[model samples]
Target: MKIKRSAATIIGEVSALILTFLTHWVVFYFIIINSFKTRAEAARLSLAFPKKWQIIENYSYILSYGDGLFFRSMWNSIRLTIISIVILVLVASMTGYIMQRRQGKFSKISNKLILAGLIVPPSVISTYWILSQLGVVGTLAGLTLVEVATMFPFSVMIYKGYMATIPRDIDAAAIIDGCSASRLYFQIIFPILKPITATIVILRSVVVYNDFANPLYYMSGARNSTIQLFVYTFQSAFLTQWNYLFAAIVLISLPPFILYLILNKRILEGVTAGAVKG
Candidate 1:
């Protein structure tokens, strides 16, 4: 039997789509339009095209500003992201696999703690104090640790939920075939986890890359800054230079945007597969 769609449902769907389009259009329009305008024109924050386009000048100035500080910040962001993701993937995968496979009081308690981490916010002052005691308070390494720790709980939950779907027969079979626990997980089980892993990688990478609050709190004293920090500093220094600021925003946004475009299909597949399996 064919079910007919109601008029209200159709209207609601259309309204939702229009709202979504307008939201994205307004944001991109502001960024792209202002990016091409002169400082005075951009200051107006107008939706119109620039009377005198200064694309080249604006971009050039941003790139060369403060001895190429933008590029430095970009590199810092890349480094921090890479380190954080690598550690997160390795640690979370292992922890999740263990938590899912091992049935005991310990696992139950650990699960509760991990869930609590999701609900609770970290104390910035306490974290700062710990880092200071470790003598890495103002260093990139310290910030990397903070990022990995912050992201670990969510990543582990994703992996653990996905691991629940895998049959215990696989583990028993691998063990009977003389595979050690480490070898079994790394060689056999990890391969099966590719879909969920891809989801974690894409989602967590975006979060860590675009993170502003963690870096702001933990890395304020660092000599080199992350891309977001650089933007904040640039805004303060060039308070009236809206054109340059917008240009910088566009450039900084390109890397993650390009990454998402390239891997969007995989991201969707991974997320859906994880959700269904979990």
Candidate 2:
């Protein structure tokens, strides 16, 4: 059956798109335009296009700043994002699979804990203290672990929801063929989970890559900085160079934006599938 949309519904949808454009696209345009301005001109922070473009100079300065600290920070952010995503995918997927397949006291307790994780805001002080005790504070490994922990609960929920949609009969069949539990999951179930995995990867990759607060809290020092933290180098008490700051922002924002553009469809599909299935 086909349904006809009301005029009001069409108008509402169009209005939402216009609003989104004004809020997001307009802001992006403002940032891009300002990034090309002189330090004094950028300080004005107006939507007007730059009268004098310092395109190459601004970007080059940002790239070559602090003996190429920006590049090092970029590498650090990338490494953290990749490591976190890999661990989250493997651990969360298996945990979700087990939680879905097994129903018992342990599963119940775990579900409650995950629920709590979603609701509870983690204490930065406590987390830092714990990391300090573990002797991992200010290290990439510690930061990676924190990133994975932060993302784990939601990832597991998505995996568990999607896992429920997969028939248990498949597991029975695989087992009947002498597939071990680990083999069945890795070879069969894991491959089938690519869609959700892609969704998780793109979404979480952006979060981890763009994360400023966690990195600031857990990982200190210039050498340990992530791309987001590299922005601080542009500011000081005496003066702030808005042009260089905006330019750096533009450069750092590109990777995640490009990634989203490439895999945007998977995000909606995965979320919707998990929602409907679970």
Candidate 3:
């Protein structure tokens, strides 16, 4: 009975893996093959291979489009992503640590608010009004703040979970050694949080980089557009340049795809560390 059950489990796992691979590969293949095709060929959106590859033309045009708007958008995306992640990591990690260590009414209320942040749907109109009042509605700084706010709750939760696994004896020892509160957290605790920090950074970098809606709502115009918005140049109400669009998508997707491939194991390890290690 045990042997049969083991065989059944193995078969189920293999089947799920094959299905996932095929599903993802088909989408990947379609986008890539279309990216190399001519505008007319790509418009058809068929599964067939391109008769004449326009690799250089398609990719080059996308790069040089609108006096290098693509490059500008790419830079904007990188900048926004970096700024947001740094702020989020600093603020969220500290907040998580405090919430875990301290016990009081304020901490309890803060915890509830964090949970509310995760559950509540954000209001674009209200956010716009607030940003408009502050005159940061269309700037990178405004968008950076928005991204940080949006990602805060999840990061805090992750940190809090992982922080629980760390023994309180460490805190007691550090306090006994004449460490100030700030020093204890920043010097002792923060360094120890490398695993969770890495998890938050890698995971949130991908999210902020690939974000479409937040950028669309908070920031506007060609000058301030992110990579996701850069794709809009190839699309229109009357007509869509399918090949150029696909090429732009390929370029936008590469960073996150490469990141996931390189750190996939680390991401898994970080996420599971709290649960498994403790």
Candidate 1, position 221, lDDT: 42
- lDDT tens digits, residues 128-193, model 1? 999999999878899999999999999999888888888999999999999998999999999998
- Clash number for candidate 2: 0
User: Which pairs in model 3 have colliding backbones?
Assistant: none
Residue-level lDDT of model 2, residues 1-278, one tens digit each, is 98999999999999999999999999999889999999999999999988998999999999999998999999999999999999999999999999999999999999999989888988899999989999999999999988998899999999999998889999999999999999999999999898898899998999999899999999988899899999987888988999999999999998888888888877877777777666
Stretches of model 3 off by over 4 angstroms after superposition: 1-7, 276-278
Order of candidate numbers by TM-score, starting with the best: 2, 1, 3
CA error at residue 124 for candidate 2, angstroms: 2.0
Q: By summed lDDT, which 10 consecutive residues of candidate 2 come out lowest?
A: 269-278
Judging by TM-score against the true structure, name the best candidate: 2
Candidate 1 deviation (Cα RMSD): 1.9
Most accurate candidate by lDDT:
2
- Which structure is stronger by TM-score: 1 or 2? 2
Each prediction's Cα lDDT score? Answer: 0.87, 0.92, 0.91
Estimate TM-scores for all models: 0.94, 0.95, 0.93
lDDT computed for candidate 1: 0.87
